[model samples]
Target chain A: MKFDAQWIAFITILRKEVRRFTRIWVQTLLPPAITMALYFVIFGTLIGSRIGTMGGFSYMEFVVPGLIMMSVLTNSYSNVVSSFYGAKFQGSVDEVLVSPTPNYIILLGYVLGGVTRGLIVGTIVTLLSLFFTDLQVHNVAITVAIVVLTAMVFALAGFINAVYANSFDDISIVPTFILTPLTYLGGVFYSISLLPEFWQGVSQLNPVLYMVNVFRYGMLGVSDVDVGFAFAGVIVCIVALFSYSLYLLESGKRLRN
Target chain B: MAHALLINNLHKVYGNGFEALKGISLQVEAGDFFALLGPNGAGKSTAIGVICSLVKKTSGQVKIFGIDIDKDFSAAKCELGIVPQEFNFNQFEKVRDILLVQAGYYGLPRSLAEERADKYLKQLGLWDKRDTPARMLSGGMKRRLMIARALVHEPRLLILDEPTAGVDIELRRSMWSFLRDINAAGTTIILTTHYLEEAESLCRNIAIIDSGKIVKNTSVDSLLKTLNLETFVLDLREPLEVSPTIENFSLRLIDSQHLEVDVTKGQLLSDVFSRLLQEGVEVLSMRNKTNRLEELFVSLTGSGAGENDEI
Candidate 1:
């Protein structure tokens, strides 16, 4: 496709993907906001007050960043998997396959849709966090950068999951058995520094741990892991997953034939 | 270069190691109505799949409007539109949205997309259902929706894989005229159908494939010319208690009021009338036992030409 056509094509798919999730606002947009609000009441107000302060901040302030990050990660991953797989199951993917649209545009369009949803839900959860405690942006540049980067990383992962998924069940398997556990153990509720030395070493290997801490460092100005390492690790993951997703689109494994 | 579509030595082998198409080649002239006829598993859809880029080709070259798919697939694809055998659109989308969204895929701006979407929807007689969800459409309407979607881009080449399957007679004829008008206006069309009568009445040129091979490829007239015999059902003027034996013509008494007559090619119908008059059996009216093209298809595809083939 020509440059202009490619841009239009990307925008079309991106708009369609956004419309799909937005149209189902009750299921897509509202659920995360409501769930996170509940977390603030239960975990932040009730239990957090009893736990007192941690990491030089009130417990409510500390867990707020982690809850926002968790919302971003889960929403980003779920958006792409469900939307892309819905397209595949209905064979509507062939609509784009037969068009002049290039492979990368298709990948980017879906990824951006995922990222948009992630960020929207993340922002909602963050606003809900404010009602629980007074929160401040420790670093404006780092906050925006980490939030966008975190959304992109998980959105790419969702794209890969959708590509390999042969069934609706396949799309959910990773989130149910793997992603949920990673987010919980990724220092979302507590800093890895609070763990034993052996488990902290193990937590270093969990990719989600880096994302949560980096985002926490952006919001709280303190991180259990090195700041540079967190950013570098997530960047490498985004690049690697994006490349693999592009390869799958070009290969057309379960898509074309 | 004069052809709208050209396939040279095309082949396809599924991952299961089953070869669906074996070195088949074809050329469809611009503004011509062509038919790719085959029985179940004859690879007609596979061939269309390869052309539309839905199914990856194992090996060969395909060009649309002289642009080779491999070298300039974007240009080639822009010139092409395909409606597959099955309904593949989003069932939840409004009918109008389906067509409008399809126009966007080809880079049409919102204004032009709405214009083309309105044009095709009205043409396909789906205007009343424009706001209706696609899932609410009947089977025939869904089929028409696919056709409308394909034409929204105004592709130079249009491929319909059984576009009229299961449509009622009225809607089917309307679709036929719609296709004819577009073809007359210079859009090249390639159709695949189980209904031989549809192909015989609509297509100008034809190709018959079976078992991963092209059995015949020629003009429709030329293919019909190969028929050695034709069976006609004659409505008798009067009932007969005893069937009369006729010389030099194969005859069977279907009932007292009907007779099945098989006439060899190059034989005139007047001869049969003349003989029937001499036998004191006045002729009323007659029609071919089956469509002429159907006879040829059955003869070419062997026992695989299932009269009710869903494919």
Candidate 2:
């Protein structure tokens, strides 16, 4: 009920979450950084050299924003899904649930934790990419806005996943079966314009494609997808996921019982 | 005094049509140490769940401190604190942190939360482990930490679900004393424990639930009086086989040299001694089994002995 007190709960959960991942930084923070570096090396360097250009920009430059977005999305989603599910699995979520904290406060506390991890991993990957190719941001506002919004959207998605997950494997199933496939097909390395007209239209439906193109537009001032549509798509996903996650918490589906 | 917790016609039927609670109703008075005793699968946990809003009730209403849980859940919950049976604190956090965070959840400022955290952690004898991660503490310590966390908000009613289960005798005794102190200070305590002796010692009012219904609900003294079963044990100086005529004493062999029997209040012990002597069974020393609550619990639940008596 008190704003100051609710903020304290939010900060407490956020601190615990940050400490949880940082305590095992080798597992939580380092893996994504290493994976992103590998992507920059293998796809950005080796493949980009052979492919020439994408959307009027050098392939390496074009892929930089997409790869960063990929890291943000995966790290943000996994940070919340794994942490929240781990709490449930360990039977520690009862500590939070039994407390007087409102459902929305708990939801935001976890979302912020996810966003923090996303931003940290994104920063690390950005610095890693600099070792291979110089990058520039055409619009700093759009760049920061897209990264934060994408992280927020995915973090909410992860919260929903944690709500329904009965086991640890359930948390990873979405990433393996759905997330990986969508990311690989979401224009991380090549422009959607290169695909056939039918495929181009089909790719528009993949939410990750919209995110990747939006980030690309921010960094290189070029995108195969319409920039205005990309921004609208990200905003809509954020609002939708946020409302759905809050509804799930309020209903206590798979959570209270 | 107003009731601290009131449940009216509560029902919970699982998805498979297994009714855990069947229109059960009960009231716990303010400042009363009420014990809810039942066998496993008898809906003890389900009742607690419904009261805490963790499990949905198929029908009925729950009021805490005169506030309807359905219409004013936050206000109702503000008056209650639940110490679950499971150790459910964030194990990665320190003992002090867990308590402080719990206080914050109740809308307490940081300074007030810290003060209450320190107060409870010290009172629960967890001050020394304040900096230790919860996961690293012993089971007893963890259980105490949960109690501390629950009490941080100073709710009017506290619900403890098996608070002493799996704890050592020393810790359990200390916990009982702590609870007694809290109850004396006017916090209504509702406890569910497998230990009948705990209820006998701490609770004045008791409810015996079986198959989701209140089979027996009465004052502890009245319940014990209704049983009228007194246990007497005689230790014999010499081992002897009792004569068949000694059956008049209604004795059973507790061991080769010992005889045990349950006698009503008006029954005479002298008659039993004379009958045993007539049968050539030597009696050296006699004593009464003082754990009357255990005996009553066994009788009411229709369970033969103490082995499976834990609820």
Candidate 3:
């Protein structure tokens, strides 16, 4: 297909993916915002009042960036996993599969769709945080770049999960067993500096820890991990995940016969 | 004239070691309406899947409009459209959006996509249901929606797997007319149908497949001409005590009121009527036991048409 046509095909898939989640805003958009708002109330205000500042900032302020990143990560991952798995389940993905659309274009379209939802939900949670705490961004470029990059990484991961998923239960297994635990343990509510030296070393091995730290550094100008290394690590994850997802699509794994 | 679709030595084997297609080769000429008749598990759907890229071929060559699929499938697929047996569209999407989205996948501009969507929706009689979600449509309407969606891309070749399965006779006839119009206008169509009568009526050329191979491939008229014997069931006006003794014809009394008679080539129907009349038997009505192509299909496939025949 010509480049122009491929672009149209990409846009079409993206449009369909966007409309899918938007059509069910109550399920896709609302729950995350509500969940994040409750976290701010229960964890930041109610619990943080007893604990002093960590990482050179108040508990509420320090936790805001982590909460936002958490929403972005989960929403991005869930959006692609659910949307792509739904397409596979309904066999609607055959629409693009039988078309002349390139594999890369299809992957990009879905990845961007996850990114869009992730950013939208992330912004919603960020705004919701303002009601509980005054949020500040130390570096706008680092903040925007890391968030977008992090969303892309998780979106790619979700795409891979959806590709290998055979049933509705399969799509949920990763998020529930893997993603949720990683977010909680990834230092979302507290900095890893407070952990014992051995546990801090173990936490460094968790990829989500790097993402949350980079995002926290962006928002509060403080991070336990090196920001440069964290950015490079997220980029590496994106490249690896994107390549694998593209290979799955090109090979027609699970999507085709 | 160029061939619209060509498969040379095509083969497909499933992961479970079931060889669905065993080197089946066929050609469909441009502008012809073709029927691929087969029994269940005869590999008709698998072949179509390979051509549409829904199924991977173990070994073979498939080309659409002279473009080789393996070499450049994207280019080959651009000229092809398929309506699978199952309803595969998003059920929650409005009818019009489905068509428009399909058009966009083929790189149709918004104006052109809308125009084509409008044209096909109106043509398929789904214009009024444009805003309604696909799940709300009846079985026949959903089939029409799929056909419209396939045509929105204006593909040169269209493959429909049992396009009229489960459709009412009245609606089936209308769909046949619509398909005839499109084939006349130069879209090559390959249809698989359980209704042999549908194939006999709409398709000019046909291939009957059995056990993953093309048992017979010829024009519809030629295949029908090869059926030298046809059975007719006669409803008698009164109950008969025994079968009538007709010379050079086989007759069996299905019950007492109905008799099945086989008439071979060069046999006169008038002779049967005369013989029955001479035997003091009155016939109320007479109809063929099965359509011409159906009889030949059973004879070739060696499988009773009972389980496979939906018509």
Q: Specify the highest-TM-score model's number.
A: 1
Q: Write the per-residue lDDT of candidate 2 for residues B94-147, one digit (tens) a residue.
A: 889888777877878778989999999889999999999899999999889989
- Candidate 3's residue-wise lDDT over A1-25, tens digit each? 9988988988998998899899999
Report the candidate with higher DockQ, 1 versus 3.
3
For residues B183-235, write the lDDT of model 3, one tens digit per residue: 99999999999999999999999998887888888999998888788999999
Using DockQ as the measure, the top candidate is 3
Q: Pick the candidate with the highest lDDT.
A: 3
The DockQ value obtained for model 2 is: 0.53
As a whole number from 0 to 100, the lDDT of residue A130 in candidate 2 is 94
**Taking the tens digit of each residue's C-alpha lDDT, what string does model 1 give over A20-119?**
8888989999999999999899988999999998899888899999999999989999999998888899998889889988889989999999999999
- Regions more than 4 Å wrong, model 1: B303-311
Candidate 1 chain A — worst ten consecutive residues by lDDT sum?
A1-10
Off by over 4 Å in 3: B236-243, B255-257, B274-284, B303-311
Distance (Å) between predicted and true CA of A209, model 2? 1.2
Lowest-scoring 10 consecutive residues by lDDT in candidate 3 chain A? A48-57
| DockQ, each predicted model | 0.78, 0.53, 0.84
